[model samples]
Target: MYKINDFSRLSETQAAYSAGNTNLLLYDLPQHYSDEYRSYDSPRLCTIINGAKEISVNQSEHFVYKKDKFVLLPPNSTVHMYLPEHTKALVYEFGDQLIDNVRQRVSDKLNIDISKNDSHETFMQDTLTQRIDALNRRIQEIVLENDVNMSFLIDLTCQEMVYELLKIKGSYDIIYHHQ
Candidate 1:
C-alpha cells in the first residue's frame, strides 16, 4: 500500500525453493522513505542500487543505498525501509533456503570449488543492474497504464527479472553455506 515501487511486479516463479516448496510472489512496493515497519510473516531482501533507503529492524535503523548494498529481512521482522526522494531500489521476498538455489548454480557455472565466502552475497550485482531496471520499468509501465494485460505480463516479466538476478548471484547453487 506504500509508494515503494514504481512498477507492477507479477511473477509465476518461486523466489525461494526449498525441497521443491516455492513461495509465490509478484510484489512491487511503492516508493517509501518511511519509518520502521515490520514483516511478521514473510522475509524480505533489499537489493538497493541507486536510491537511498533507511531501514529499521527491531526498532533500530540502518541506511543503505548503493550498488554494493543488500540486506536480508528475517521472517516476522519488525523492520521498515525508507527510500528517499528520487531514489530507486529492488526488493525480493525470500523464505526457506534460497541460498541453496544460488549455490547450486554458481558452482556449476564458475566451475570452482567455491563455498559462500561471505563475499558472494553481492556477487555480480552490477552486471545485473540493467536487467533489474528493465524489469522494474516493465512493471511500472503496466501499473501506470492500469492495464488488465498486466496480469500476464507482470508474471513473465518479474520471473525473468528475478531469474536474471539469481543468475548474477549464481542462483541457489552458489550463495548458501552450511555454517
Candidate 2:
C-alpha cells in the first residue's frame, strides 16, 4: 500500500516504490520513445492493462491484447510496455512466499484464466488505485492512533489486497472461462 508520488524520484519520474518486497506503480510511457531497447531491463512482470500495449521481449515484438492480457516474467527478464498518452497501469510486485501464496489463492478463486484479448480500460486502473489508497488510509489511521497492531493490519491489508487485485485484474477471464 504505497503511493508512487511519495517517493523522491516520483516527483520527476517513476522509480521503485520502496525497499519492500512488493509495490504497485502507475505511470505513462512516452510514445515512440524506445525503438532499440526492447526489454524492461529489470526482473519484473509487466502488464499493459490500458491503452495500446506493445512489448518486445526475446527479440520479438508482440502486442498484448486487452481484458486481462498480462506478461509474465520470471525474474531478470528485461521487459517494457508501450502505452499511449493518458495510459494507466496497475502493477503487482512481490517475492514473499506468503504474499505469493495469497495471490495464488486469489487467483485460484478466479480459476486462473488468462486473457487472449488486449482491450483494457482506464477505469479499472483507477479502481485498483482506489483500493490501494484505501489500504494506505487505513495504515495512516492506525499509525496516527498509535495502534500496537500496526504490523498485523499491514500484513492483513497486503494479503487481502493482493487477492483483491488479482481478482480484479483477471476476474473477467475467470468468469468468462468458468462458464
Candidate 3:
C-alpha cells in the first residue's frame, strides 16, 4: 500500500501543499515513469494537464489523454499508472477525515445518508474534465496568490468539487450510497 500521509511525512523533496485538510500534488515528469500497483488510503482526484498516461485498475487498462480526461480513485483501491515523457498532472489527495466531513455536510444539507458503497473503483469521466481543469487552474491561482486565508479558499473549492461530482449520475456512487 502507498500511504500518502506517510509519503508526505517522510519525503522532503516532493513539493506538496496543504490547504485546509486537502493535500495537493503537482507532478511534472520529464521521462517515462511507471508506478507499480499500490493502494491509496485516501481518495484521489487526478487531472492530466499535459501528455498521456496509462492507468490500470482491477486489470482494466485505460489510456488517458491530456487536458481531456480526469480520474477519480476511490479509497483503498489499487492502481498502476505510467506517465510518458513531458507529462504534467495535478493530483488532489483527500484524507479520510476530510471526505467524512464533506459527506456529513452534504448529507445534512440534502437530508440524505451518505454512506460508503461496496464498490471500490477508478472512474474516468470525460464530461467532468472541463470542470476539473477549471478547478485546477483556480487552485493554482489561489496558491500563487498566497492569501492569508488560502487554506479556507482551497477547502471551499474542494467542497465545491465534491458537490459537483455528486451531481453526476454514476460518479455519485463513488463517494456514497443512497439509503
Candidate 4:
C-alpha cells in the first residue's frame, strides 16, 4: 500500500526532473537501478524515453524498451521496476478528473452511457507510445521555452495523452468497466 508521501520520497530520490505541480516526473536511472516494490496512489502512465526496464506487476514481468515504450499502472498496483544503465523514462501521474472529463465528452459525443461500468484496471498499449512520445517532446519544448501558457499546454497535452489511450481498442472497456 503506497501513499502519496512514498511517491514523493521516491521522486525526490529518483526523479531527474519533476514538475512543480507534481503531475509529471522524469527519471534517468543508472543501469541496474532496482526500484523495490512500490505502489501508486493514483493511476499513472510510464513511458520509456530511452534504454530498457523491467516491471513486475501482479506476478507478471514486462520488459518495456524502445519498441514497447509505455505501460499504464492502475491505482494501488504494487510494482517492481528494474532499470538498465542509462534508462530514461517519463512518469505522468493523473487523477480521475481528466479521465472522467474525457469520458463525459466521449459519451456525449456518442450518445451513450459510460457510467454503467467502472473498473479500475491498468492497461499496457505499445501502439500509443509514439503519440505519447511526441506529446512529451512537445511539452518539453514548451517548458524549455518558458511559455507563458505552460500550465495550460501541459494540461492539454495530458488530456490528449489520456484521450489517445482511451481511443485504443479495449482500453475504454478496461477503464470504464465496473466490477
Candidate 5:
C-alpha cells in the first residue's frame, strides 16, 4: 500500500496514469483553481487527499472539504469550488446506470425500495471510513501499476465505491435527490 501522506508522489503517479487516457477517476492537483458555478451530469464523490476545498452551493451554503471526509454531489446541482495550492484530490463521477444497478441490488437485498422522495435536491458529506480508505488505496495502487487490465480494475473499484456509498445512512436521499 502506498503511504497516504505521500501526496506529491501519488499525484505524480495519478497524472502519469491519466496521461495515457486510462484513468477513470479525476485526480486533481491544482496550484490554485476556482470555478464560479458548474454542474455535473452524474453524481460525483469528491475525496480530498490533501489540502482543503471550499465549496458553495446556490451561493448560500458553504462547505469546506478536507482529508478523511468526502462530499457527494448529485446531478444538476450547481456549485462553485475553490482549491488552494498543492491540493490533491480524487473525484469519482458515478454513471447513472452503475448507480441504478447498485441501488437495485441493495434494495433487493434489504427488501426495501431505495429512492429519493424529497421535493428538493441536496448534497451530502460523511466521514471517510477505513473501508473506503482501503478501497481508495487499492485504486491508487492499481493505477500506479499501469497494468493492461487497469480499466477493468478501475471500473470494478468505482462500482464498489458506489455500492459502499449507498450503504451509508440516508445516502439514497441525496443520491436520488434530483429525481
Candidate 6:
C-alpha cells in the first residue's frame, strides 16, 4: 500500500484520469485550505492520503478525517471542507451508470434486493483496510498507465470497490441513497 508521501510522489508524476463521466484525481493542497461549501451533483469517494480534513455537512458539527480515511458522499450533497495542513488525497467521482450497473449485479449475485432506502445522512466515513487500499492503488496504477484500455480497467476496478463496499454493513444506506 502507498503512504501519503508515496502518493504525493505518484501524483506529481501522473495527471488525473477521466473515463466516460468518472474522474480520478489527486489533490495536493496547501495548509489551511478551506472551502465554505462544496456541492456534488454526483456521488464521490474521497480518500485521504495525508494531512486531515475538517468537514461539515447539513450544517452539522465538523468531522475530522485523517490519513487512510475515506468518505462517500451521495449525489446532490454539499459540505464544507478545511485542510489543517498540506494534504494529499485521491478523489473519485463515480458516474451514475457505473454505480447502477454494479449495484444491480451485486444485488443479483447475492440474491438481495438492493433498492434505495431513504435515510437522513450526510456521508459514510471509514478507515481504509488493507484490501480496500490495494484496490485503490490498482485504480491509481491504471490511471497513471493511461493505456488504451485505461477506461475499461478503471471501470472494472471501481466496480470491484463498489461491490466490496456493498458487502459491508451500513454501506447500503449511503451507496443507494437517492437512487
RMSD of each: 7.9, 9.4, 4.8, 5.1, 6.1, 5.5
Expressed as tens digits, the lDDT of each residue in 70-106 for candidate 3 is 7776666666667666677777876556666766777
Residue pair clashes in candidate 5: none
Q: What's the CA error at residue 169 for candidate 1, in Å?
A: 3.4
Best by TM-score: 6
Clashes of 6: 0
Clashing pairs in 3: none
Q: Would you list the C-alpha lDDT of every candidate in the order shown?
A: 0.45, 0.43, 0.64, 0.61, 0.65, 0.71
How many steric clashes between backbone atoms does each model show? Answer: 31, 9, 0, 6, 0, 0
lDDT of 2 at 123: 15
TM-score for candidate 3, please give it. Answer: 0.76
TM-score, cand. 5 vs. native: 0.76
lDDT string for model 6 (22-124, tens) is 6776777788888654334666788876789898866778899986778887776677888888887887777778778887777867655445565636578
Best by lDDT: 6
C-alpha positional error of residue 55 in candidate 5 after TM-score superposition, expressed in Å: 1.2
How big is the RMSD of model 4? 5.1
- TM of each candidate vs. truth: 0.47, 0.43, 0.76, 0.74, 0.76, 0.80
- State the lDDT of candidate 5 residue by residue for 62-89, as single tens digits: 7777878988777766777777766777
Error of 1 at 152 (Å): 1.5
lDDT of 2: 0.43
Query: Residue 135 deviation, candidate 5, in Å?
Result: 1.4
Better of 2 and 4 by lDDT: 4
C-alpha lDDT (0 to 100) for residue 111 of candidate 5: 45
Ranking by lDDT: 6, 5, 3, 4, 1, 2
